[model samples]
Target: MSGLLGNHFITQIGILVNDIEKTSKAYSEFFGVPQPEAFLTDTLDKAQTEYNGEPSVARAKLAFFDMGSLQLELIEPDEHPSTWRNYLNEHGEGPHHIAFVIEGMKEKIELLDRKGFSLQQKGEYEGGRYAYIDTFKDLKVLVELLENDKK
Candidate 1:
């Protein structure tokens, strides 16, 4: 995690879907597991959201499934202009981004910025913050950095 270019372990894989209920059920059936509960992002507190580094009201329906050490995240973008929405609009539903769990978000974001990876979207949850870095052009997928204070 010291440099911008290298092999980084992915902790989560995020997918953009049109319907979270349908997708979660389908994935649950496929994995022979119970369907995960979906959460609305807008309901979170102390949430500061941004799109393309500017303040924005981007919301989404999110669900997570634990798979051993890595987690799979499902995202259904709300009717707003956001990274997820733009991704859905441009490419339809599918894999959207891969994420890494970071400890120091500010330092990591600064490193990415210095490396020319712009912050596409960012938001703060109760005990953590998450950001999406613009990496689709080179990696064919957006990159995410998550910093959880609880962890």
Candidate 2:
């Protein structure tokens, strides 16, 4: 559990929020999740969703933290009718999405894309390159690809 290679089928849940500190504090107070000592950089890109039979890049933001074995990610975007921001603005922000960690990210992205999962955003963080896909219908949820789990 200490090492990334173990993987151990971790379930990563996320909440999208417009304010980082506010959401972090909220989760910490409510769920007893540990607070991060420092902020990490998350470089994001414009993403598109094909759940509606068309594709377009909506607004998005991402942040990360660890909760024991589960990885908690926070995403918030300015809405032009987007999933993250829209959910936060509408539902009031708690457990927005979840991710399953798997190996071979490049092939997974290609395979998921070929299977109709649309790419929303792609970026590189300290851990690895990640691609968020809009699996809006297939999983009835947004799927975030967590890669380079080994540090």
Candidate 3:
């Protein structure tokens, strides 16, 4: 089914964790998949990260476990102020956001904004960009928007 963001396909489920090594190992063993190596996100200049409407230097170590059509992502954030760091601090380590892959990033963000969903943070990655929207009050989880560059 489709929603305000357009398509309803959930591409990823992000979790905040205190320890990436231990947690990723456990998940790997449980899922019978090789342990995915954790990698640091891009630096601030490359990532062009913004948090709470201001530029930020936040970064995180991330590991992804591909589960069929969806991915389970583990995030261990640094001390900087970011969506990952803030959520990890406030909620202590658990499910953080459910992400959807979309096409028009700017339009989707604007639509969500019109609906009163605040954009908490945004950043760029190697292949795509992401935005974290504060949809916790209604959905019990933040909603992430992933827009990959067309190859």
Q: Which candidate achieves the best TM-score against the true structure?
A: 3
lDDT score, candidate 1:
0.88
Preferred candidate (TM-score higher): 1 or 3: 3
* lDDT, each prediction: 0.88, 0.63, 0.94
Runs off by more than 4 Å, candidate 2: 1-8, 37-65, 78-92, 149-151
Model 3 lDDT per residue over 83-137, tens place:
8988888999999999999889999999999999999999999899999999999
Write one digit per residue (lDDT tens) for candidate 2, span 53-107.
Answer: 3343554555567777788877766555555656677678676667767688777
Question: Which has the better TM-score: candidate 1, or candidate 2?
Answer: 1
Q: RMSD, each candidate, Å? A: 1.9, 6.0, 0.9
Please tell me which model should have the higher lDDT, number 1 or number 2.
Answer: 1
- For model 3, what is the C-alpha lDDT against the true structure? 0.94
Summarize candidate 1's per-residue lDDT along 56-145 as a digit string, tens digits: 777899999999889999999988899999999999999999998777787778888887888899999878889999988898999999
Backbone clashes for every candidate come to 0, 2, 0
Model 2, 85: alpha-carbon shift in Å?
4.8
By lDDT, the best candidate is 3
Provide TM-scores for the models: 0.92, 0.64, 0.97
Show where candidate 3 strays beyond 4 Å: none
What candidate 1 gets wrong by more than 4 Å, as runs, is 5-7, 43-45
